[model samples]
Structure formats: structure tokens, C-alpha cells
Target: MTTLEDVLALVAIDSVSTNESALAKYVYEHLIVNSDLEVERIGDNVIARSVGLHSFRVLVAGHLDTVPGDVTASVIEGDVLHGLGACDMKGSLAGMIDLALDKTPRPVEVTWVFYAREEISRSQSGLLEIAELRPDLLVADVAVLAEPTGGRVEAGCQGTLRIKITLGGARAHTARPFTGRNAIHRLGDLLSFVALYQPREVQLEGVTYVEQLQAVSVEGGVAPNVVPDVASCVLNHRVAPDRTLDQAVQWLRDFLGELLDEQDVVEVKDWAPSASPELMNPHLTRLVEISGETPQAKVGWTDVATFREFGIPATNFGAGDPLRAHRSDEYVTTDEVNRFASVLGEWLRSTPNTSGTSI
Candidate 1:
């Protein structure tokens, strides 16, 4: 059976994005063992539900995959459980599984989703797949993503955009650099623009969000001996909810227009638009009150946006620091896990009907 110890044991195995079969199997059996919930299996995605005719249902979700690579035990150190999947969501998964085990006979139905392939591209997200196949299954009064929020409710998420700015110039021998237009030298102006660009801070639904723009990568030069003819830079933008993906892309096009060729280099590499904090809902607010913590807007992108895309309200609340996730010293406090489990368990047990009433 999957106990708290079992959860820690699951974390010990490297289930990084590609190898989630073991972890998925573990969850599949764990859910089956505790309740007579209807179960469905697809790839490494596991869905188990307690049937009910309640006016509303609740969905609990956590990703089963982590980033690639493994962290040795020496790196984990003491109680920190330093490993790849320790914080990003394995701990959350453990908490949710524990929640599932402590089932109730209440009228409110509960759904547990343990999905795969969250670290890679969104198109490949396991949640997206379920969103298509069983939209109704995901339909709920509220959704909670146990995505390492340090036990506080985190609403919404920032959008992300990656674009390449290409600079063109003439090539010549380095010894006679003046003979060539320095493409790399042209990038200096763009770099300065990036260095001085101040991201905007926008407020929405009582939450403040910060936008960020940065030059994440640069590539150029055929050789040190030759003045490069082509140079390109990668820009990463964390946009606020005020803008759409289209607007964000257009903004970048305008920002890099001076350095980029109008004809040869206008294309989007990858863009994930942001989501707004939907905490205006009374039920969501009550959840915050019950947790006894002020909610914050998540600065990073997460599957909360996916649930939002379905028009379902979602929040991030889990037991560890997101900063610790994916780091060599990744770990979650056992106290946090116990507290998270208790808080979530109590909330699940006490969430009154939010249909026509003010919860």
C-alpha cells in the first residue's frame, strides 16, 4: 500500500518525465487499494473518481513526472529529500494519494488525477489529453493543483514567450575586423535594450503580477578568426495577464525590430499565455480563509492555466517551496506534508455546498 513512507520511496525512484511508468503504476494501485472508485488508465495517466450526484464536484490534480536526470543521495542531505521530483510534485502526489485513502461518504464527488509529461512541451501535457477525452470528468466547482505552493494558495500564472532576434552583418578576417560589419557588435544595442527594459507590474482580481524580459541565450560566430555574418539572441518574456499571447509576440516584434531583418526573421518560437487570478469566486475565497493564509499569484507558469482554459477555477497549493523544486537540494518538510495533508483533508471534508449559498 502507498503510505507516507511509500510516497518517499516513490520519490527515491527517478520518474523524470520519460520514465513515469513505475510511479504511475504505484499510484494506480494505491488508488485502487483504498477506495472502490472507478478507475481508468491511459499511458501513465491515472484517473480515479468517487461517484456522487452532488450539485458540484472537486478535482485534485498533481503531475507524476519530473525533469530528466537523477540526484544522488549525498546531494539530498538530511530531511531535505534532495532529488529531482521531491518538490516539483512527487510530494504533492503523495499528499493527494494520502487524501484519497482517507475517503468520505459525503455527497460531493472527488476526482484524483495523476498525469504524466508535465515538464516538457504543453502540447504533450497529460492533463491536456484528459481535458479532451473527458472534459466532464475534469468539470468541477473548483480545482486544486498541488504544485508546490509552500502551503499557501497561489492563483493564476505568468505567460511565457521565447523569440529569436537575428542580426545580420558582413563576414571578414578577425585581423582586419573593420573590413566586416560586426553582426555580434550589432547585438550590443539589443542587449542594452534588454538590460534596461523594466517589466511592468499589473494588478488583477486583487493580485499583483510582475512582467519580465530577458536575453536568455546568444549564438553567433563561425570562428574566432572570422567576423560572424549571422548572430541571433533568444529572448524570454514573462508577461502579465494584461496581454494576450498575440500582444506579447507583437510587443517583442516591435522591441527587436531595429535589430532584426523585417523579411528574414519574424517568427514565434514558443508562447504560453498567462492566466488571471479567479479568486473572486466565493468558494475560492473561502478556501483561502480555511487555509488561513493570504493567497499570492504564481510567478511561474503551471497547469492552473490548463484548468482555466476549460473555464474551471484552479489554484496552486502544496507543501514545498517551488524554488527548491528541480534543484540538487530539493526536499519538502515532513511537517509541511503532514500539514498539507491535514488542511486538504479537512477542506475536502468540510467544503459546504457552494451552489446557491455563500460558502
Candidate 2:
């Protein structure tokens, strides 16, 4: 089948966040039947590897699950495939499958990973599942995460720090709100501070990563006629590679020091650390050279960070526009998928200098 056909076929299968069993089974069967590589299935994750005893190994990976969406409504118009996961990932998954099935000899050994649960929390990541269950499968000199970069080398990813801040107040009648502190009223100043935040840009390996802060959710209400005693707001901060999660949290505390009261409570809800741009690595530098476009920092979080935790220098490179991911109108073009496949296939076939001077 053609690459576009493969993308449509995969999109037709519903693999939303926690519902990836059928798609995982399909991928497992396809790899087992079409490829001579060693295939393994851990939960919903499928891994295929070519153990050619080469000095260098390259790992290509893409998540199997997408955020919840209607799959039956997916369609193709002209040369574009429109669907929920078409752009965010299915397009690149198709390319990875084709490359995995290719019998052509390459200078480096290859490992292809199609994992589930990437669209959800980091703790439930299928990549992390593989890392914990079978770290040996992830051993590689260099890695590439197929994360909808519009066929460019999106180097490194921004870390995410989610925290919930609760303000203390006293319950009182709505008419006598002046008798008690209005917890909800405290949100205005904090939100205004977040709204006026200036994104900090940090340069790493010639790539500029911009940081962001936003208030995603707020909670604090007892009843329509009563003043609430507690109010909480969830703040999400996108951090650069220069800061660790601890440092980012500390920075947030410092930023809000003046606005927070002594009784206010700050709690970390979730966090995922960032990865630095590994363009200095010869394999990644070669990938940047082959794409014929300057590398850009990935502003959002991706499994590339997870790969970095495994000591694998990885970058995001794939089909489709990342800006369109998770949207109802997401799409992937035939040219985008073809270009991704060509560049990645060529990278696999050619040998890097390993002198770390390619960039």
C-alpha cells in the first residue's frame, strides 16, 4: 500500500489515549509479517529492531495514541489526509513502518518504536513503559522522535511544569463578602500577572527556545449565594532547557512571591523535564544537514525528553505542521509525508562522520 493509504488505514483505527489496543495489534501483526527484524510487544507498545551488529544504531519512534477525536469522519482531499492524528503522528508512523519494512542495507542498525499513551500524562507514557521494561531495546547512538515537525529538525523540547495554587479565605454570605476574604477575587491579580508574562528566550546549539506561562484552570466556589473559603488555580509553565524542574518551580515561586499571601499553598501537580538540543551530535547534525532547513527548538513537550532521560540524544523530525496538532482540522500532505520518508530513509542509509563536526 502507498504511504497515504497507510496513513488513512491507521487513522481509521481508533487509538485515542487509552484506547490503542486494536491499533497496537495491527502494528504488531504488520511488523511481524512484513519485516525480518526482531519484534516485541510490551503492553500496547510495539518495537522492531534490526540487530545488524553495526557500530552505530539509530532509533526511530512515534506515539500510537492521539487525543480523543472522531476517527470515522477522517477524509482525504486532493493530496492531503485530514483526520485527528493524521498530522500529530499517523503520517509519520506510516513512514516509519515503511522504513522498518525496507530490506535495503544501511550503514547503521535501526530500531522502530510505535508506542501508546503519549498524548496523556508523562507517567503513563508507553515510551517510559519500554524504558522501564526493556531499556535494551532503546539503546542507540542517536534517536529521532516522529513528532509532527513539518519535516524539519525541531531540536530539543520545552519542559512543562503544572502547579496548583490555593489561596486562603473565610466563608461569608455573598451580601457580606466584605466580612471575609474573597478567594476568587484573588485570581484576578495572579491571572493578570500571568497574562502580562514575557516569554524568555534561551539559545542552545543555535536554537532559541521560548518559555511560556499560562493559567489553565481555576476552581473555588461554594454556592451562588455564599463566599468561598478556598480558591485554586492551575498554572502551566513551559520551561527552557537551561532550567531543571526544581529550578523552574523555584522561579515560579519567586515570580509570584509578592502576589502570594503567607497562607497561600503551592503544590506541584505534574511536571516533565526538558531536553537540550543535541545538534552537536554528528548524527543529529547530519540530519539537520539533510533536511536542508535550519533547526528550530520544539516549543512544546514531546517524548524526545523521555529519550533524553535514557541518555539517547534525540530530536523531533516528522511530517505535518505541529501547529495543527490536536485540532479538529488537523491534516498531513502527501508531499510532507514523502519528504519525511525520503530524508529519514537517506539518513539511515548514509553514515555520519561521528567526528561531531558536521554541524
Candidate 3:
């Protein structure tokens, strides 16, 4: 008999972004054969809902894929597990699987979603596809996204917009630099602005979301000996959730208006909206109480924003140090996974008649 630990150890399987077929199938098949839950598969995403007597449906979700890496999951000191996606969030997925196998009566209707390509972008994310394919499963009073939070309740997220800016100038041999205007120099000006620019911090719903502008990458000259004819840089802006995507883009353009003109191209390559704390909502409040933790703003863009767009209040809470996410040394403790499972499982098991917070 394969215990939940056996299944969790399957984190050893490689499920890099856009390659969640194996893991998705594993979750889909397990739900179908082992439980009476309503299970459905849409593309590489799996949706399973517990058939229980409850007024509110709690959505527990974790992404199925992680960035490319080949570290095999391994046990360390009988408590810690180290691997490519361990802290980046395979641990959260493991906890979800544990709850999915629970045989106890759930106080709230519970839905488990194993999504694909979350490490990609919101447009390609399986969560978005599931919303379009089956909005029925998306409906819930409140939701929890298992993003790495080191076990605290991280509410909401900052919106993100990646803009590609192109600067043009004449190309000439470095020996006669006076014959050409250096486009790379123009990029330097943009970098200077971003380097000195101060980020904004806004307090919303008892949490503060800090906004930032940063240059993630830069590309320019084909050869070192020649003055660059074109230079392009990708700048990512993380805006407070209070600002919409359109609002963030417009702000970016206006902020760079003096240096970048009509001829210079500035395009939004990607964007994702922010989620609100909705801290006062009963469901989120219950999670906070059960976890015995305070609220913090989720700085990174996450699926919590997807559920927020659907009018369902959402928050992020998971096991392990969030800072360890996506690193080569990614790891988590079995103790942490069990603690997460115990807290959330206890909340699910509490009946409406027992706790006013049941949902």
C-alpha cells in the first residue's frame, strides 16, 4: 500500500514548466481511483472536488510545474526533503495530495486544483484555462494558493507588467566612435533612472504592498568592436494591487516619456493583476486564526490574483521558506509538510456545528 509519503516522494519526477503531464496524470488517476470525489481533467490540469455537506467551498491549489532543474527529491536526516521544486512548491502540492486522500467529513466543500505552467506566465497558466473551461470549479467563498510563504498567511499580491523598450542609434566602428550615436548609452540612461527610482509602498487591508521598477535583462550590440545600432531592455514593474494592469502600463509610459519618444518602441510583453488582502473576509480570517499567524503582503504575482479576478477572496499560505524558492538548494522538511497538512486538515474537518468559522 502506497502511503501519502510514498506519493509525495514522487516529487522526484521532473515536471518542468509546460511539462506537467506525468504529475497531472498521477493526481488525476489517484483522485479517480482512490476517492469518491468528483474528478475531471482539462488539458494538463486536474480538478477534484470532495462530495461533502458544507455551505462554503474552500479552494486549495498548488502549481504542478517548476523551473528547469534535475535535482532528484531525497530525504535528509529523516525530516528534510531537498529537490528542485521542494521549496518552490512541490511541498505544497504534497500537502494538497495528503488532504485529498483524507477520509473524514469536510466542514466545507473542498476543491483541489493541480495546475500547469504557473512557472510560465498567467496567459499560458493552466489556472486560466481551467477558469475558461470550468468556472463551476472556480466558485468558492475563499481560496488558498500554496505559494511558498514559510507557513504564514501571505495575503494578496502585487500586479506585474513586463515592458520591452527599444532604443535606436547609428552603428559605427569603435575606432571612429564620433561617427555614430551609441544606442547602448541610451539604455544606460534608462538604467540610471530605474536604479535611482524609489519604489512605492501602499497600505491596503492591513497589509502593505511595495511597488518596484527593475531592469531584468538587456540586449544590444552584436560585436564589442562596433557601436550598437539598437539596444533593448526588459523592465518589470511590480505595482500595488490597487492599480490595474492598464493603469500600470500607462504609468510606465508616462514615467519614461521624456527619454523614450514615438520612434522608440515600448511594448507590454506580459502582465498579471494583483489580488487584494480581503483580510476581513470570514474565510481568510479563519485561516489566519487556525494558522496562528499574522498577514503579510504577497510581493510576487501568483494565482491568488486569478481567483481574485473571479470575485473570490484569496490568500497565499504554504510551508517552507519562501526565499528558498527556485534556487538550486531548494528544500523543505517533512515536519513542515506535516504541520501544513495538520493545520489545513484540521480546518477542513471541523464541522459547521462546531466552529462558526467553518467554511
Candidate 4:
């Protein structure tokens, strides 16, 4: 089947985050039946590798699971396939599957990884599962995370930090609210600060990384007549590669310092580190050359950071628009999928210049 067909088929199967058993099984069986590579399945993650003795090994990885959406609502109009996961990743997955099934000989060895739980928290990442259970399977000179980038090289992903801030207040009678502080009312100042936040832009290796801050969730209520005594809100900060997790957290604290009282509590709920743009790396540089498109910074977080943690220099390159990911109107075109397949196929078949290699 064509890559477009594969994408439609994959989208038809329900593989939402934390529930990717069926899709994982389909990918595993397809690879086993159609490819000559060694395939392995660990829980919902699937890894397929070519055992050819080569000077370099390249890993092409994509998440098998997508965010919660209507799985059975996939539609194909002309060359475009519209549905959940169509843009965020399934389009690229189809290209990866095509490459995996191809019998063409390439100079560099290849490893195809279709992992699970990428849409959720980083702690439950299927890539981490493979790294813990079978590290050998992921060993590669370089990696390409097939995150939706419209077939261009989206170099380096931003770090993500989720912080929860809780404010304390005293309960008071509804009629006599002036007697006590209202924590819910206190949240207004914080939300206003977040709404007026200006994104910071940092440049590295000619790519600009923009940092963003926004309030994602808020909870604070008691009863219709009772005044709440406590309120909390979760803030999601997209940090640049220039700062560490601690530094980013401190920056957030400083940003909200004046608004946060001594009694207020600020806690780091979750965080994932950022990855620097590795355009200097020969393999990635060659990929950019092959695509003939200028590489841009990956504004959102991706598994490239996870691969970076493993000491593998990775970049994002895939089919579909990054902006359309996770939206109900997400889509992928035949041209986008085909172009991704062509560029990646050529990159794998050709040898990159290893003269001035620097990770």
C-alpha cells in the first residue's frame, strides 16, 4: 500500500495516548511480514533495525500514539487525509513504515522506532521504556524524530516546564466577605500577569528559540455560599535551550515573585529539558542540504530532547504542518508525505560528509 493509504489505515485504528496496543500490534505485524529487518515489541513500543554492518547507524523514530480525538472520522479528499494524528504524526509514520519495508541497500544502517505515550507526560514515554529495557536497540550515531514539521528540518526542541502555584486564604461568611481573603479573587492578578506575558526569543546556531508562558489550568472553589480558603493554578512554560530546568524554574519564580505572597506555594509539577540545534552535525547538515529548506527551531517539545538525553544528536523532520497538530481539522497531503519519504530515503542511502563532525 502507498504511504497515504498507510496513514489512513493507521488513523482508522484507535491509538490514543496510553492506549496503543492495537496500533502497536499492527505496526509490529506489518514490519515482520513485509520487512527484512529484525523487529521487536516491548509493551506498546516497536523497534525494527537493520543488522547490516555499516560505518554509521541512523535511527528514525516516531510516536505511535496520538492525543485524544475521533479515530474513526478519518477522511480522504483528493490527496489530503484529514483526521486525528494525520498531522501530529501518523503521516510521518506512514513514511517511516514505507522506508522500513523498502529493500533498497543503503550505506548507513537504520533503526525504525514507533513508540507510545508521547502525547502525555515524559515519565511514561515509550522511548524511555526502550532506553531502560533495551538500551542497545536505540544506540545510533544520530536520530530523526518524525514530528510534524511539513517535511523540513525543525532543529532542536524547546524545554517544557509545568508549575502549580497555590495561594492560601481564610474562609469567611459569604455576606461578610471583607473579613477574609478570597484565594479565587487572588488568582486574577496572577492570570492577568500571565496574559500580559511577552515571549522571550533566544538564538542558537542561527535558529531562534522562543520561550512562552501561559496558565493551563486553574482550580479553586468550595460551595455556592461558602468562600474558598485555597486556590491553585497550573502554568506551562516553554523554555529555550539556553537555560536549564532549574534556571527556567527560577525565572518563573522571579516572574511571579511580586504576585506570590510569602504564604503562597510554588511547585514544579513536571519538566523536560530542551535540546540545542545540532545543525553543525554533519548528518543533520546533510539532511538540510538534501531537503534544500532552511532549518528552523522546533517551538514545541518533542522526543528529540529525549534522544538528546541519550547523547544522540537528533532533529525533527516529518510530513504535515506542526501548527495543525492536535486540532480537530488536522490533515496531511500526499505531496507532504511523499516529499518526506523522498528526502529521508535519499539521506539514508547517501553518506554524509564526516569531515568536521561536532555534536
Q: Which candidate tops lDDT?
A: 4
Task: Give candidate 2's error at residue 220 in angstroms.
Answer: 0.6
lDDT of 2 by residue, 1-359 (tens): 34688899999999999899999999998899754599999999999999777888899999999998888889989899999899989999999988888899898999999999999878898988998999999988889999999889999999999999998888899999889887888877888888999999999989999999999999888899888878899999999999998899999999987789998999999998899999888889889999998899999998888889888899999999999999999999899999999999999999867655433
The sequence of per-residue lDDT tens digits that candidate 3 reaches over residues 33-112 is 64659999999999998876777788899988988887464445456777778887878787888788777666688989
RMSD of 2: 1.8
TM-score, candidate 2, is 0.96
- Each prediction's Cα lDDT score? 0.79, 0.91, 0.82, 0.91
lDDT of 1 by residue, 1-359 (tens): 22346456768766778678888888888788864588777788899888767777789899989887563462334445555677787777888887787756655678889998999989989888888887766777788889998888888899888888778888999999988988888888778878988778888887888888988999888787999888888888998878998888888777766666653364568888677787877656767877888888888898888888887788888888888877776777666677677777777877565654532
Task: Give the better candidate number (1 or 4) by TM-score.
Answer: 4
Better of 1 and 3 by lDDT: 3
Comparing 1 and 3 on TM-score, the stronger one: 1
Separate clash counts for every candidate: 0, 0, 0, 0
Worst 10 residues of 4 by lDDT: 350-359
Assess candidate 3 and give its lDDT.
Answer: 0.82
C-alpha TM-score for every candidate: 0.91, 0.96, 0.89, 0.95
Q: Give model 3's TM-score versus the native structure.
A: 0.89
Q: Name the lDDT of candidate 4.
A: 0.91
Cα-based lDDT at residue 134, candidate 4:
99
TM-score of 4: 0.95
lDDT of 4 by residue, 42-93 (tens): 9999999998888689999999999998888899999999998999899999
Ranking by lDDT: 4, 2, 3, 1
